[model samples]
Target: MRKSLISATAIMLFAAVIQSCNRKAETPMVHPDFETSYWIDIDLAEHPVRGYWRQVESLDPEEVSDSAGIANASRLLAEQYGANKLYVVYHRQFELDDARRIFIHWKTEGERNGLEIVPTVVLECYSEPSAMNFSDSTICDFASWCVENVNADEFGIYDVYIRQDEGSPQDTQMGILREAIGDKLVRIGLQPGEDLNSYCRSGVEDTWTAECQGLDNELWANPDSVDGTDLYGRKLLASWVAERADSAQSRRIVWNMIPVAWDYDKPVDDRGYVCPGDDALINDPPILGRIAKCHECIVEGYTDGMLTEKFGGYSCDLHILQANSAGHPDSISFYRQLRNGEPYTGYFASAMNQVSDLYKEIATFKQAKSKK
Candidate 1:
């Protein structure tokens, strides 16, 4: 509560003092050059529970394989409006020379696509069965594989994400990564609203949260930064101080918003697009509006970076949690995308008409629980 009040006051004072003369407006306005430059990390898995990328393929076997749909989805993201880069994470989907085969294939596709594709290789899912670990040999072996076989020089793994879900920080993991794939950017991802407190060994539980410990890499959400029931104030930036901080990574806020899916148990097409459920976010206006507002704040925050020249020193990557069972493009129904259910199979049936008929079934029959 105090932090929220303080933040509100600080931001208010910043405007009052920082711009006493040019204060023609009452509220903050985005600059003319303001543009969203943050990378949108999109996860492919729907039900990425235990053996998501490593062991099992999908919730069903008859539909789209996890490995095949990524390329098309990557292309779609590249072609979309608010997204310029795809920070994709492919742990172990295809049959790898254990993993080497699929890693190369993913990179090749990324390179061919010609977008800002940051392929991150996970080296820290030690708890989950079949997931990668952080052992000396394991770490060294993966690092060596990247440098030697994977070729860290090409469109290689630029960023490496470590998922320590159990809240146990591998204190030595950073040093080893630095020594080996130091050229590659390394950051740790923590599950928001969970046992992040355990990550902080120091008893300063007030401000030093598990999110703040990322120092370099901050919140990496599979679904979102905070759950729908939870407020943003309750999690992020609650325990951050600009001055009394150790390093640039720890000094400020950094988040990676990867809005795709949390428990994705749906069917997918040839494209990486997942067939959204009736309870999917696209159906609820209130939640969908919230998601839009969250992205709006993220864009505003990133644009604010233009104010400071030296703020670059702070290793900040504020993730706008654009998550939750990746948006159903075919069912872009609520917003002018919904259309007629009748099939115009006569001479008038055209390509455009067929496109509109995509989600006609849902519009004609399906009713969301919230809507009812």
Candidate 2:
């Protein structure tokens, strides 16, 4: 959570829960609270994105080029999970019927799922070229349309690769996004390996800053070997979290975790979907402890392999099911079948529910102590 999030967001969080109740209805729910934008859950600090709904799926260039398929999967996400945030990162242009699928169809499902669809548009950041910068108002228009049309919960930005004259690319984009989206959340998705201390230490004068800093933890976070003093491993991530928490307090940057793990062993060029069981993360108290330190954290979505039929790809769920049915030496198979007889989605929901409780316990304790 951002340092000031507690006092500022308590009311919004309450309103959102109320709004979520509308999911019982068939039509999409609009937030009548502030303006007419959809009521989005602001209890990021309170909600530890434990298992299921955390980047449920993403609209990337590599994903299967099927808008209808993606939309259907999104609908299932809402129908199955009820109300939870679906963190989707859009890196390419709205290809095919992507616009309707995302804004109209996806938004409808978003309401059903009680979504906080943080549309982090990384237009030029990716090689696919989202071409989002049609003009000064392109990104703004996109965001405005989401709120007014789709009634999207939140809008996030991953700064462009190119630099601006006044500020860095990210800083410039963040400003534009905030102005366009109005009071809706304007989260800044930070690049992987970004260090808060570097920004603090840089003598360069800067006036802009984002309240939250989202890190794409994925598989990069947990490494098999330690690299010098860098605390980046299954055993050392807790230390990294502790250090990051200290910086978060000073800078008031909300540590939002965005995971898409595809590597932890080989270098980037040689990476594969080899993660399984507890190899990527220890499903235990210590790992949960690390997660609690962050302001907001999402569960890893390496389950695409198992969900590829419904979703594009990763396999955290299959990995767990396999470990249980086939079994693993060092890990416990939590589920007996795919989603315990349901699907991969069900498995994630169950895992997140259990993990979320523990994370909240630690987060609540740590947050209270910090104020003292």
Candidate 3:
């Protein structure tokens, strides 16, 4: 009887171990926090608007067929992803005063998805043309002056692009520009020319030459090459601006300033889209890190009275999203639903839920650490 009992006990123990192993195998592994490290930098050239449209068409058939549809769809997608305003930067050939105002035509007017969406004008001002061969210090100083002297009430945000001159090192120029701007205002760096692969590629191969003349031309011609960094910066800045605008008792008024590549007379592409390649950058892990860094800077700058003195408290929510004009018709419809404030469905809904879960996990971790 004793021998039989021992064998039965061993068998039960073995079965328990096997069950434990199976349970472990069935459980999904928890991923590390996205904020832990910078992941891949987005390559815009790899994902174009046309490519997105193919996916969109599979999902929805009749959403985006013309320029108006494209514009409406873009705005809806932008808003659903947490964008407060849309802007198109106008860079002209002639040098305009820092205070000059050029009115671009209004975008498609109407209420879509029960939200009043009005597209605003974004004008670029150059202190000097590329021909002037301005030094780094000169450019920075001019940009600083332009930002400082601008009427905050009139303009929500200032999008300053320090033009890369011939023979100037892009990194050195950007560093100097940042230092010059200091905590007074935040500015983003843009790629200088048409060679998207030159700046977008990994390693030492990424280099930009100031061969491109006008900002508009460079952006329009090589929209694929435009760095995601710039778009991320713009999104970050816009979020803060939107938050401030929403506030009622706020003393300081912030405006949205965008650096755009504009061509008025140019007809819409065969795809019937305006600014075909000018989609907002995707907010992947690396881009999120960059956005966080920018947010930190803005917070510190505001606390130090570097950005403005009138506003006592300023905060922003960063929930930026990206969509391509070339996405499928279904994608366009999806955007419309999102813009209308409907609950996200399908993959987007699942993805957003995952993001929410991650945030909760991080919160729990922080709470536990605090108790310790």
Question: lDDT scores for all predictions?
Answer: 0.33, 0.34, 0.29
TM-score to true structure, per model:
0.43, 0.42, 0.26
CA-RMSD of model 1: 17.0
Which runs of model 1 end up more than 4 angstroms from their true locations?
Answer: 1-46, 49-68, 93-98, 124-135, 147-169, 188-254, 258-292, 295-372
Better of 2 and 3 by lDDT: 2
Candidate 1 residue lDDT tens string, 1-372: 999999999999988886864543323332322222223222333333332333333323212234454565444333332333334443433332445554555456556654444444444342335434335565556656756654553112212232333433443454455566544543324333323222221111121122212111212111232223221221233222222132343322233322222222322322112223434443222111222223333333443532332222111121212222124444322111101222213211232222223212212222221233
Scored by Cα lDDT, where does model 2 land?
A: 0.34
Q: Per-residue CA lDDT of candidate 2, range 126-218, in tens?
A: 323223333456667766776776554556444313332346554565466666666554334332334432222111111011101112233
* Per-residue lDDT value at 267 in model 2: 31
> Distance (Å) between predicted and true CA of 134, model 3?
14
Q: How accurate is candidate 1 locally (lDDT)?
A: 0.33
Candidate 3 per-residue lDDT over residues 26-136, each given as its tens digit: 432222211211001011121222112132212222212224433443443334433322222212221233212211111232123222222111122223222222356
